[model samples]
Target chain A: MIQIEQISKSYNAHAALKQASFKVDRGELFGLIGPDGAGKTTLIRILMTLLLPDSGKAHIGQWDVVKDYRKIRQHVGYMPGNFSLYRDLTVEENLRFFASVFGTNIKTHYHLIKPIYEQIEPFKNRRAEKLSGGMKQKLALSCSLIHRPELLLLDEPTTGVDAVSRQEFWQMLGTMKEHGITVLVSTPYMEEADLCDRVALIQNGEILEVASPKNIVDHFSSHLYRIKGKERLGLINALRSLSLFTKVYPFGEYIHCTSDEAVEPVVISQQLGQLGMDEIVIEAALPGIEDRFIELMA
Target chain B: MDSIIIDQLTKKFGSFTAVDKVSLRIQKGEIFGLLGANGAGKTTLIKILTGLSGASSGKATVAGFDIHRHVEKVKMNIGYMSQKFSLYEDLTVRENIQLFGGIYGVSSDYIKTKTTLVLDQLGLQDSAKKLVKSLPLGWRQKLAFSVAIFHEPKIVFLDEPTSGVDPITRRQFWEMIYAAASQGITVLVTTHYMDEASYCDRIAIMNAGKMEALGSPGELKAAYQVDHIEDVFIHIVR
Candidate 1:
């Protein structure tokens, strides 16, 4: 369980966090969704007691982040944005080192890391540097859990990883949540936002909206339409030139067009036909977190 | 016209075979995408094509030059931008562009005119005099891409050029790629983002040094009975 109140941090002229406030329920999987330089890392560092906030307060289960830094470090597990493992050491050695640093042994927390560790146990003797990106991340997660911390903080864990590996890593985090460990993960991928129980969309050092993924999508106050045509570029240009549409963006094979009020699909089709677009298909659609985030930012 | 041709291309490092008997062709001005998990041989294959690594067996030709006998010629006809952007952080944006232009043997007078055009196109004219480190990640990526193709190479290779960028910026970057492709510049890109594969004219999914699937995004999704490219990727890789 973590609580943050009116936290504000700045470095020289740039303010990284401004009156940012949020809370994570006990055993909840919370996500910080935003782009780089959006203060996700700064906030996480503040909670880890690695950086002091300029103002306000934060607590991790009754222990103040400032005064009880040592205790908080002992009770928290952090995996930074970049993989931070002893490259020269073997996988097993790195795990042991982290366990020893926390005043514990691997055996003491074997059950806690069994699910994640077992995946990489076969390569225990291999050096960390030789492992693949996915393997290295799994090793990092294993080391973080070697101490059986109550809270886990992951910063952009799946940023550069492949789709399958990203799915597996999220599945691992889901298991950790079931084990009663409070999880807070940050990511730039908007699709992953739905996986968290609740997410805080932060941008430019401010919290835009904090809600469940479904609730966030439900709050989108505009009607969305998915439009597909043979000429992708022409379709985009035509849709953007339309005066009725508020926003038009390319989404995979189709363009997602939004309007301030409900509009008939036939009206859009007629406009595209006049623009010489071919094979036009228009259908009503639901907006996702990414669309909602863009709307809020706008 | 074919920009690239390969026959049973294979690369081995020690006892490990990084690329195993791979064969594919990229048409002129086509946007080709490579999707694979880490260590799945995507990098090894790209290195071989770009003349950064040697192939242990088989034959390949890039831009009409045999990769085995004419590696330098292959390099001359191709441009590459890695995930890291390959820009000097300490150098100002204009200085970095000038450095790359000089390396590519472009005339100084032409570099001046091209530099201004590129900056204006990316809307980075205001930041042209600033150090690359001071610019945002998205701007740096766009600049890196522009520099990679500054020499007007026949083919451009981009390796995860949109990694870590915001969604909006990533879309804008793709528009740049589209603009280049329309100008008859062939593109061979590798990315981990499955959603991006849809934008490519055609894509190949590699697994364990083997080409597992190859088709347009719609065709691949149809083959796998999925609605999205992400599902197609998961279905193939899993």
Candidate 2:
């Protein structure tokens, strides 16, 4: 439903987005996955018509982002990374205000946000500022959906949220997807990439890769290994010093070591095993979206 | 050898108990991870330990100073960095370093030397004069961390310091934490990134204002019969 063509934006000397281009199918859940300052926000703002692009063009559905800004704003729902609800107003008041701004009432589109709104309904009387981080986000999402916009844009909604809450937020997005809403979301978390139908990995104002999560992993050509040892830092240093591994970084319970050429697991085991380290385990592993992103950036 | 000790610490707001008699001990040169959901009293507990707020009951000592009786002393012994508040966006990179150094009561000469050291270490010597707002989020976060520990405090508390940062910068930030802990600095960190729990020497999962689980990452996983710390966290909080 959205199309971007060579969109470029810059702040003085720094380029926030450079020749960025992507497309989102109607009723599809598309993710713009990148770290902070990776131009995810800038791209979203350009599509939302809040910021003018320095060059190129973008369209939200049938309307051009620049020529039809008014129409785009009316049909697009945006939840900024920073919560933009009326902090001094109560939760109920914020929802009502957003609905009124769109020339509608809460009851007109109550079903659109029912799944998320009901979670924070008991705290309807609480001030927006007084709610917890998770609750505030839910409230923000509810307000964004109050008018039943066809397109939803969320910028890093789960960036700082805990695991369980992040999961719940994504589930809400899933419900929106099932409702045939075109959702364009951005996040710095790579694990969440799997939740999207397709994700474009952007970094340093560049769109490095775009594909389904499974396809991105399938494109990983290097031999990756999962190595675990008793000492974390020591093992990383040892692997880095070997010069044989293309990449080595800590990944949860183990260190992910990648090499262009396939190497035997026994070789790594024997090398670190001589360093007086105990309980060394090494196994060939599959690359995740994060590992692929690092490789693309490298 | 303990850098922090807590005995049934409780923080109550009216009839609500944000921290319900929570107890924990962190050793010198250890990387301790604090894992919890939002409003799980992690921030409240940190505030009490850092002397920003008072505890309703319980006893706690940070860096050998009692939090209740020697709040000022406790403040001097610890450093804190959170995602929401860290550095002045309007100030230059070097000025922020010097400003924090002055706040910690360091001498002008030491501040001058450390400022250069920090800029060089972070490879921001060219951007030292640039306002902190001009830097990328990753670079800004690294500078904030360096400034937080500029005074050489005995303990450092990081509350989701890498929340919105990328995977690569997040790892580099952890490298700095590893370096600091090796230098005899105690690090108490909270992160929403569950993979990070494995990086800590020990982790404590708090739920409903209480310490629900505390152990090494491996131990917690084994106890909960899960392969990942995220699973352990869900098992406790969910």
Minimum summed lDDT over a 10-residue window in model 1 chain B is located at: B163-172
State in Å the error of residue A266, model 1. Answer: 2.7
lDDT string, candidate 2, A33-107, tens digits? 998789999999999999999999898888999999999999999999997999999999999999999999999
TM-score of chain B of each: 0.97, 0.97
Question: What C-alpha lDDT, on a 0 to 100 scale, does residue A173 get in candidate 1?
Answer: 94
Please give, for residues B126-236, the per-residue lDDT of candidate 2 as tens digits. Answer: 998999998889998998899889999999999888877877887888878878888899999987678777888899999989999999998999999997788999888
lDDT score for residue B196 of model 2: 70
C-alpha lDDT of residue B145 in model 2: 91
On a 0 to 1 TM-score scale, where does candidate 2 land against the true structure? 0.93
Provide the global lDDT of candidate 1 against the true structure. Answer: 0.90
Off by over 4 Å in 2: A125-127, B107-113
Quick one: best DockQ, which candidate? 2
